[model samples]
Structure formats: C-alpha cells, structure tokens
Target: MLTTGNDTVLSKRATKTANTDEFLLTQFEKAEANLFHAKDNPEGIVNMGTAVNRVMEVELIERLTKPDALRFEQRYMHYFNNSGLLELRQAVADTLTRHLAPDNPVSPDNLAIMNGAGSCLDALAYTLCDPGDVVLTPTPVYTRIFTDIEERGQVDVMPIVCKAVPDNAEESFRLYKETVEDKILETQSAGRRVRALILVNPNNPLGDIYPPGLLLDIMKICAKYAIHFISNELYSLSIFDEDANFQSVLSFKDIPDPERTHFIWSMSKDFALAGFRTGVIHTCSSSVMKCLGKIALYQCTPSLIQHASATLLSDKAWCDDFYLKINRQRLRDRYSCCLARFRGAGITVRKAKAGLFIWFDLGPYLRSRTKEDEMDLFQEILKRGVYIVPGTQLYCEEPGWFRASFAVSEVELEEGLKRIQQVVEERKQKGQVSWSTY
Candidate 1:
C-alpha cells in the first residue's frame, strides 16, 4: 500500500502526485470558500493570491456580448479541426504579428491552440522530453509550473535559483547567462540530461522584462547545448511602464535555434479573460508541431469559444484602438495605488514594470528569517481574512518574501491591505523581531 504525506492511501501511480507539496491549491480553496463582496459579504476573505485582473470585467462583458461577438453557427456544433479553428489561429497570428513581431510575421500553420498556458506547457513537456529528463527555469516563478511539467509527463523541473542581493533589491532574482550555463553544466555533470530552458518574460511576481541582448546571449547558449528554449510571453500586452522595453522572442529575426525555440501566449492575463481557456503556442519546428497535433484532441478548446475569441482578437479597431490602450492605463493606475498602499504600510516592495502582482518583503514582521516563520505570518494574515502567496511555494530559496495581486477592484484592494496592515501592527505590538535585528 502507498500513502501520500497526508496519509491518504492511493495507488503507486496516483501517489506520485498525491505526495507532492501543492499547498497553493489548498490555500486557494480556503480563499474561494469565503470570497469578499462589497455589499454581499464585506467580512469575507479577500483573495490577493490569484493572478487575475478583474478591472476590465465590465469592458470584456460589453464587448463579448455584442451581436457578432459570439454568434452560433451549425458548423460549430459538429467536429471541426481538433488542433484549432483556422479562423482563430489566423486571428492569433495576425494579432501577434501586429503586437509582438513586426519584422517576422507569425504564420497560422505553426500554432497549436490549447485550453490555457498550463496545457501548452504540459504538451510541450510531453513532446520535448522523455521521462526523467530535466527542464530548467529560474525561481521564484509561478509555482504551478512544477506540477504542470511533472504531474503526468513524469518530467522533473530543475530550478536555477536566483537570490536577492541586499544592496540591489531592484536587480534581485535577475537571471544571468553565466548562471544559466553553469547550472546546465552542473546538471549534466550529475548525469542528468537537460532538455529545455523556460524563460518567462515580463515575469510573474518579479514583473521585470529581460533585455534583448541578454535574451540573445541565452538563446545562443541553448543553441550551443542543443537544448530547447521556451519563451513564455503570457503577460505580453500587460506592460504598464512607459519605459519598459519588452521584446518578444517572436520579434527576433535571427534566433540562434529557431527550430528548437518555442513561444507561448494566452488571453488570460493580458485581456483579463482567464475564463476563456484559450492559449496559443508558436513553434517553427514541424516535428514538434506534428507531435502536438496528435495530442491536440485531448486539450482542444471548444469551437464556439474559439469563434468568440477570434471575433474579439480580429477586431483591430476595438483591440488596438480602445481596449488595449485603456487596459494599460487601468493597470498602471492600480499598480500605483497598490505600491503606495504597501509602502505606506511600512513594507518593502520590489518595483515591478509589468504583470498583475507585486513581490514584497514581509521580513520585518517575521520572528526569524525562515520559511516556517514566513508561513506563520502568512497564516496570521489569512486569519485576518486576506490571502497572499508565500515565496517558498514559488521555490524561492529565501524566506520572508510574498506575492499579492493588485488587479482586484479598488475597494477589495483597500480592504486586503488594511487587513495585512492590521496583522503587521499586531506582530509589532507583540515585539516581534524586525528585519534589522533578524
């Protein structure tokens, strides 16, 4: 008989996932059970942990419910393309060409549409690597990547742990070419094959974009090692900083390993359409595309939903002229408000240029600089009716760091911050050790 860490009996195959530490989902369940609403349940929990942008909900509803947006057709009710509708893929290609790659226009034939970014990653894992092969990604990242790659694919994620320097908090967790190569060599020396490297641009939690030169250098390294390079541009259209120089890998003309490089994007973050369950993958390799096609039936999006998505994406007037421009402004405003609130609460936050969340330090509130203490503070804040993710769950080697989304409504954001402030003040009054002393 096999059992997980919580002592639930299961088959050997099932125990593999059951034994893994997926605490984020557990916390999310708790948060969802008591979600806060302005008039309905003001005393309920405020979820700051999930990376969802709720600011554009009304706008999305308005556009999606229009006459031509989601019109039903008889053909849509029958089986069509299992990979994706040609209409939707072409629309995605056109949209990516306009925003991401001006020089190299994207081709619809190279794309594979899935339910979401998680499905894309899972499919890539299955196609690119065999069981027991390693995929490298820098930490602290979105924690779900671990299970996404490993759960059913039976692959392992090797973390290229990037530490935060005390003197340069702005450049904290920055991934360097040297560090990447070193980790690759180290993993090879251990007799493990490194099949791929994943780069999250306009990174989640950190929210910093990689410079083009660095990207080129890393791509060259992947070429040298004959490994796959995956560029996850999930937050491509969410850049709020006027000075942010975000260049998608799709924009690069001379990719060192074009055949081995892949790009991923989704409507979830940028368009505030997480419920849409639409994700796109663009790869130049025909072999990879062939492999993906065989599995597309298992992860394909509904034809009706694909039609609606195409309608929204193909409308250049609405998407480019109004929605995107207004969305960026709203994200900028919300980010500014959240940053000010955290700083005013006497907490230290890492300045971010993009993404829905902010990575801030709760070191001052910890009794000691340890993950246990970090989680203690997390539970205390949750008890006060606010839920935020602790950094340890994201494979952050250091303690006392946390990520919280500011994409909620203004009222919810204020209430969540107030609860956090109450927890901090309570800790301080009880004479907890500050960051300086710790």
Candidate 2:
C-alpha cells in the first residue's frame, strides 16, 4: 500500500507514476475531446501541441488506398515473423541504404521492427540497461522519451541541460562533447551506472539538425565510456531546408563503437502515418538483436500493417520519386506560412529547418519569467481554443518558450495562429510587452 501527495493511491508503482508530471498528456486528452473541425466544430480546441503531420493526409490516404497498395492475402491472417515480415524488413533496409547509409548498405538481418517509436525506445531501454540505470539525453527534448524509457524499463533519464548562452539570442542550445563526457563521468562516480546516451537528431522542439563533427565527437565519448549510443533519426526525411546537410550515423565510415551504436526510425513522422504504428531499430550488435527478438512478441507490428508498409516502401516511383519530394515541399510551405504569421503577430520564433514544430519565445507575454507564468499563458491560450506545448513540459530550464506544430491543414493552422494572436493581443492590452518590442 502507498499514498501520493493527494492521499489517494493503491500500489507503490501506481503512486510513483501518479507523482510523475503528466500535464502535457492531460492537456492533449482535453484538446482531443473537443477538437476543432472547421465546418463541424469551429469553436472547439485547435491542436498545435502534438507533433503530427496532417498536411499530407490526403496524399497518403490516396496512395495507400490504391488497389494494389494493400491487397490482403492468406499470409495476413496468419501469424508471421514476430520481429517483422521479411519483405518489410528488406524494404526498410533498402530504403535506409539508399538514403541514410549509401556508403554502408543497411542489412535487414540487423533490423528489428516494433509497433512504434515509443515501443522501440521502451524495448531499447529494457535491453540496454537494468532497472535504475541511467540514460542521458540533452534538454529540452521530446518530453515523452522520459516516460518511454522509464515507465516499463524502470530506467532513469538524466538530462544534460543545454541552456542557450545569455546575451546571445542567435546562438543555438548547443550540446558540447565536454559537457556530455563530464555528465557521464559524474554519473558513474556517483555509484550509478550510465548505460546509454540517446539523442534525437534534427532535434525535437528546437528543430535543429546536429553537425556531423559534433556527432562524431559525441560517439567517441560514448565509445570511451563503453556506453550504448542510440540515435532517434525519426525526422531524417523531414528536412525541408534546401541547404541543410542532414547526415545519418550509419553513413559514417568509421564508427568508434559499431557494436554499441543503434538507429531508430518510424513511419509516423517521415511518412505521415502515425496510425500505422510501425517502427524499426537498426543495430549491428548481435547480442542486442537477439534480446530484441525475444521482446518482439509483445510489441511486434501486425502482419497486415507490415505488408502495407512494405508495399509503400517498395514502390520507388511513389515513395522516393514522388511522396518524399512533395511532402518536403509542403512542409516547407506550411512552415513558412506559420513563421510569417508568428512574425506578423510581433512574436519571436526560432527558425526551424526540420521537424514538424517551431520553438518560439513568448517571454514578453509573461508577467515574470517563471514556469508558473508560462503555464498561466498556456492556459490563457487554451481558453481561446488553441493548444500549444509549454516549455516546462519539455524540461526546459528557461520559461516562456513554447512549441506549436505547423504540419496541419492550412485552415486549422490559420485558425490556431489566429487564436494565439488573440491571446497575445489580449495579454498586450493588459500591459504585457510584445515579443517584437524586446
């Protein structure tokens, strides 16, 4: 028997979970319950908090529903490979080889397919570390990774706080090799084992892609400490910036620790198929692959979904030649539109080169630069029928930073921005300084 702060709890594990922060999820549920549908429910909540790509929904549905696209066979009705259907794994491997690892062709044998990226993270956490072991990632990141690694694996995530340098607004929230090594050593010295270091390349919330040089340096540090390196390159194809050089870890010719390095990706983001529930892990380590095989029974993707995913990936004419190119252009267009609106509203936003959302500074809207003030502003925006993620949920040390997804329908995007602008105007009328004035 256990009790939480509210004094109503059952099991010890339930109390532990109840004590964890779930504000973002709670808001998401509320937003979903009353979603804004332009012609249906215009006054309902316009969701910009969730990182989903709805801009290409029509294109995806059209292609996926083609006659030959998802033909059902007897194989679909029977149990297949628990890891992934061979055809799907090979298709995934081939796609990665062509795009991410041109130099080193990815092998299907090294791939483990799971239900989704969240499940992949959970599986990796369980396989790579024991309960209470630490996995380090830089902040502020996708907040869900904290629970994905912790809830089932009982592992802990230690954030290497990467605060932006004061007085230099132009500088990005940079993660240094020294900072990472120091944190790793400090954690180990404290009698706790640091088993892995996970990074979301082309980072979430920030929407900045890491440099190749920095990635190499970080890998060397992980190798020096003999810890696993997991790169969540979920947005590898979401790079809309023409000049941005996005490199995959698999492309590196010389890996310091090939056996310990792993890559994660999913159809949810790149292909705009969140409902598909398909994710893959590419790892060279035989031991890790073996462990993942045993765990796949619980989290394996369904055969029919795997077949459809394979068909989509196999069609180079549609996938490589058409879908990706158009998706990137659409992403660029939506991002540009969202940016212009925010700038026009006298708000300051960090320009994003990749990913679905934009990180912007709303510090001027707050009465004080505090988390409480940030939440108050968030609630105010929510009251205006718009939902954007507050920085506090992302473990951001700084207050008044928020994320809003631009990967939505033009109408929804405009409506969300309009509501946000209304909030800003209301706050301004009440004496809050405009972001542009700063």
> For each candidate, what TM-score against the reference?
0.96, 0.95
What are the per-residue Cα lDDT tens digits for candidate 1 across 124-223?
Answer: 9999999999999999999888889988888999999999877456878989999999999999999999999999998987988899999999999999
lDDT of each: 0.90, 0.90
lDDT of 1 at 296: 87
Instruction: List the candidate 1 regions with Cα displacement exceeding 4 Å.
Output: 1-11, 18-21, 436-438
Give me the displacement of residue 138 in model 1, in angstroms. Answer: 0.4
**Candidate 2, residue 21: lDDT:** 62
lDDT of 2 by residue, 1-438 (tens): 555696766665677787776877888899999999999999999999988898878988898899776788887888777889999999999999998889899999999999999999999999999999999999989998999999989999999988855434447577889999999999999999999999999899888889999999999999999999999999998999999988999899999999999999999999988888999999999999999999999998988889899999999999998999988999999999988988888777877889999888888889887888888899999999999999878988888889999898889999999999988888889898534322
Candidate 1 steric clashes: 0
